[model samples]
Target chain A: MKFGPMKPQRRNRLLLVLFVVLAAASAVGLALSALNENMNLFYSPGQITAGEAPTGVVIRAGGMVVAGSVLRATESLRVDFVISDLQGADVNVSFTGILPDLFREGQGVIARGILGRDGNFVAEEVLAKHDETYMPPELVDVLPDSHNDPETFKGGTRQ
Target chain B: MRFFSLPDYQLIMLNWFHRLGAPRSFYEISGRLLPVLWVLSGLSILTGVIWSLGFVPEDYQQGNSVRIMYIHVPAAIVAQSGYAMMAVAGAVFLIWRIKIADVALQCAAPIGASITFLALVTGAIWGKPTWGTWWVWDARLTSTLVLLFLYLGIIALRSAMENRESAGRATAMLALVGVVNLPIIKYSVDWWFTLHQPSSFSLGEKPAMPAEMWIPLLVMVLGYYLFFFTLWATRMRVEILNREFRTDWVQRLVVGS
Candidate 1:
C-alpha cells in the first residue's frame, strides 16, 4: 500500500484551505435551515392573547402564575392555572401531570405545548422558572411595575 | 500586499508554537507538568464534589436531583471546550505539520467523546426528575448529540486509515470541519425555546446561582479541565514513546526503569 506524501506543497495547502472554507459554509447553511424549522421561541401571555403565537405549534408560554388561579382535579392529576403577563392579559394553561415541587401560585412558570382550539394553552410540560438565588430574567421582565423592584417581586424569593 | 504580514508579537507566538510542536519538547515539558495537573485534578474534584453534595443547600425546586448539576454542567462545559481544543490542535497539525499536534488531536478525541457521553447521560438523568422526561429532541440536546458523533467520527477515521500520515491528515480535516458545530451547540438554547435551560454561567456576568452553589460548580469545572490535561499529557507521553521506540532516550529510559 502506498502512503500519501508527508510534505505539503503549496497546492495541497490551498486545497485544504478551500475544503475547510467550503465545509464551514455548507455546515452553516444547513444549520440555519434546521434552525428555521425547529426554532421555538417563548411567548408572553400578551403575545398569546394578541394572536401573535401560532396555533397548534409547540411553543413556550411564560409568565407569573396568577394568584388564586390554580384548580387541581380531585380525582385526577389534571390541573388548570392562569399565567399573567403583568400587562392585564392572562393565558389559561391546562396541564395533566404532577406539578414540579416549585409550582405555586404567583411563581413564574413556562408551559410547553400547543394552543388548543378553545384558546387554552394545553401544556405537555410545565417548568418552574427560577434559579436558586434569582428569578429568570424573562419572568422578571414581564412582572408589572416590578422590573424596577425585582427584589420585591413574588417570584424573586431567594431559596 | 505582503504575502505573510503577521505582526511581531504573532511571529514570536508562532515561533513558540513551532518549538513546542516538536514531540520531544512536548514530551519533556508535559512530563514536568503532569504531576501537578494530576494532584490538582484529584484534589479539586474531590473537594468540589464533596462540597456540592454534602454542604450546599438543596435546590428550591429540584431538591436532591439538583446535585447532579455539579457533574452534569462541568462535564458538558469540558466536553464542548475539549472539542474546540482538539480542532485547534488539528489545525496546527495541518497548517504547520506538527507531529505532536496530531498526537494531541488523537489523544483528545477519545477523552472528549467520553466526556460528551457523560454529559448526555447525566443530562438525561437530571431531566428525568426535573423535566419529567428522560429525553427530548430539544435543540440543545440534539446539537450536543451531534457533537458526540463528531468526536466519535474523528476517532474512527484515524483508526481506519492504514497510513499514519494520511490518517492524521484525514482526522485533522474532519476535526476542523466539525468546528462549526461548536458554536451551534453553545447558542442552541438561546436561539430556540428548549426544555434544557440556558446556561447559568457566563463571563463578565454575575452567576444566577448563589455563591454556595456556583462556587463548587466553578471548582468542579476547573477540576474537570485539569483532569483532561492530566489524561491528555499521559496519553501524549505514551504516543511519544511508541513513535520514538527506536530513539536512544526511550531505550535508556526503559533500561533505566
Candidate 2:
C-alpha cells in the first residue's frame, strides 16, 4: 500500500499525539470530578446526626440488617425489610425479587433509588449479605457459597 | 516508610513526571514505582473486597450476591480505558514518533490485556449467578471479551516484528482497526438487548448505592487508576533511560553514577 513517497505518516503522528494528550486529560478530569462530588453527604446515620452528613441532597442511606424487620407479603411477590445506618437512621425498603439465601435479620445492605415522596427509601437495586472474601463483582457473588442454595437460611429451598 | 519518604518521595515523584515529558526519564523511576504501584493496586483491591464484602449492604433485589459488582464493574471500566490509552498512545507514537508514545503502548498493551481478562472473568462469575450461565453472547459481554483478545493480538504482533518501526506500525494498524470495538462495547447493551445489565454506576442516573457502599468502590477505582499511572510512568522511565543510554545526558547520568 506504499504510494511513491508521501504516506499519511505526518497526519497519523499528529492524530496520535492528540489522542494521547486527550486520554491523560480525561483521566485527570474524571479524578477531579470525583473529588468534587460532595464529601459530607457520604457518612451514615450516627455521622448524619453528628453534623457530619452534608445537607440539601438526598444521598444513599446505608446500614446493617435490623432484627424482626423481614416480612413476606400476604398477597403478592413483595417482601419488606428495614436497614439501619447503624448510626440510628432506619430506612424501610421494599422489594419483590427472590430473596437471597444469605439475607438475615442482622447484616449489611445498600439500596439505590431514593427516599420516596411517601418517605420510604425506594431501591432500584439492592445488595444484600456480604462477606470478607474476594469475589468477582456483578449481580451475584461468583464465589461458591451456601447462599446460592436456599436451604441454609430457614424454611426456603434453592429456587 | 518515614525513613525513605521524607528524603525520597518528592524527588522520586517529580523525577518520574519530568521524565514522563521525555521518553527516557522512566528508567530511573521504574525501579522505584513498580513495586509501589503493584503493592498498592493489589492492596486496594483486597481492601475493596474486604470493605464491600463485610460493610456494604445486600441489594434489595440481588441479595447477597450483589457484591460482585465491586470487582466486575471496575475491571470492565479499567479494561475499556486501558485500551483507549493504548490506542491514543499508538496514535501519538505514529505522529510524533515520540518514544514516550511507544513506551506507553508497550507498557499499556499488557496491562490492558490483563485488565480485560479480569473483566471477562469477573463478568462470567457475576453472570453465572444471575444470568444462569458462565458465559453470554451478550453484546456487552462478548465485545469486552473480544477487547481482551484484541489486546493480546496487538502485543503478539508487536513482538513478532524484527524492526521496531515496523512493529510499531503494524501494531498501530491493528489497534486502529480494533478501535471500533470501543464504541461497540460501550453501547452494546443499548445497541442490542443483552442479558448483561446496563451500567449501574453512572454519573447521569440516580446512583444505586448508599454512601457507604459506593464510596469505597469509588476509592478502589481511583486507586486502580493511580496504580496504572504509577506503573506507566515507571515503565516509560526505564524504557527511555535504556534507549537513550548512548546520549550525552545518559553518559553524564551514568558517569555521575
Candidate with top DockQ is: 1
What are the per-residue Cα lDDT tens digits for candidate 1 across B1-257? 34157677866776766667777777788888888899999999999999989987776556687889999999999999999999888887787677898999999999999999999999888877776567767678988999999999999999999999999999988888888888878887666555566677778987766677788889999999999989988998999899888998889888995
Residue-wise C-alpha lDDT for candidate 2, range A40-129, written one tens digit per residue? 112233433444434444454445567799888988878788766543566677877665444566655444455654446655545442
Off by over 4 Å in 2: A1-159, B1-19, B26-43, B245-256
Specify the highest-lDDT model's number: 1
DockQ of each: 0.20, 0.05
Q: After superposition, how far is residue B135 of candidate 1 from its true place, in Å?
A: 1.6
> Residue A26 of candidate 1: its Cα lDDT?
91
lDDT of each: 0.78, 0.63
Q: What TM-score does the predicted chain A of each candidate obtain versus native chain A?
A: 0.59, 0.47
